[model samples]
Target: MKVTITSIELKGPFKFFALSYRAMHILRQLKATNCLAMKKRGYWIKHYTMTLWKSEQDLKKFAMSGAHLAAMKASKSLAKEIRTITYEADSLPDWPTAEIMLKKAHVIHY
Candidate 1:
């Protein structure tokens, strides 16, 4: 399985709520094999999402199209920082393991 973990920091409370709503919407509509969303402790504007896919191509197809693409474009200005990590896994990892992997994983900043 291909797993992806993403973290995003929004500019303010309004942006955080707006983006959080959109993220939840996307999670419901996501085509990935498995997905989860969580809020970082002590940070109202910080959020994380983990998703597992059958292949990188499948992940890209979902990310590059529909509501996900629209959200990505819209967040360009609203997000203060964005980081993501993608790697192959034999099975879905628990949330704690996912967090550890994210810390060690090379990040893409935006």
Candidate 2:
């Protein structure tokens, strides 16, 4: 399946909690056939999230959807600035079985 690795660096003094909530709302509206956490790392108390998708089209559709669009419009008003790197992957490999994936990833276990 296709995948998109979005690395977002949030600007300081931003409403991180609210923006995070909005991001989840946008992800929830995505029509992707499947989604999974890829890799995640954080520095300086900021947050980083990696999510896999069925295809670029599916992800782009969500980016253009209302919730995301509204968030984008507020980028300037944000307490933190944001930067995103979107990579369009041709194929993704090494997805473990559901049980294994669930058991291994702390956040996904629930």
Candidate 3:
């Protein structure tokens, strides 16, 4: 299994609001995608998503297309920090493990 984890910190209330609105749509789109498991964490300006996929290609396909792609573009300006990590796993990692992995992941600042 391929696991991907993402973390985002919104710039402010307005950016948060805008992204939250788009997030609703992206969540729905994720649910309909080929991911094996999807989980969301955090609230307010901080948010994280942990997803399990059959392959890296499947995750790339989703990330590069449709709502996910749109969200990525929109977030570049609205987010204060963005980070992600991907690894191969035999099964979905627990929330604690996911969080630790995210903390160790490299971050990008906008």
Candidate closest to the true structure, highest TM-score: 3
Which is the better candidate, 2 or 3, if ranked by TM-score?
3
lDDT of each: 0.70, 0.50, 0.86
Question: Would you give me the overall lDDT of model 2?
Answer: 0.50
Candidates, ranked, TM-score: 3, 1, 2
Model 3 — which ten-residue stretch has the worst lDDT?
A: 12-21
Model 2 agreement with the true structure over 10-108: per-residue lDDT tens digits: 555245666677667666655343454455444442444455666777666667767868876765554343334445454442433222333333331
User: What TM-score, over all chains together, does every model reach?
Assistant: 0.75, 0.52, 0.90
Q: Candidate 3, 70: how far from true, in Å?
A: 0.7
Query: What lDDT, from 0 to 1, does candidate 3 have?
Result: 0.86
Per-residue alpha-carbon lDDT of candidate 1 for residues 35-74, written as tens digits (9 for 90 to 100): 4322233257777777777778878888887778889888
lDDT of 3 by residue, 4-50 (tens): 89889988766777887888988888878888988887788888888
Least accurate 10 contiguous residues by lDDT in model 2: 101-110
User: Which model, 1 or 2, shows the larger TM-score?
Assistant: 1
TM-score of 3: 0.90
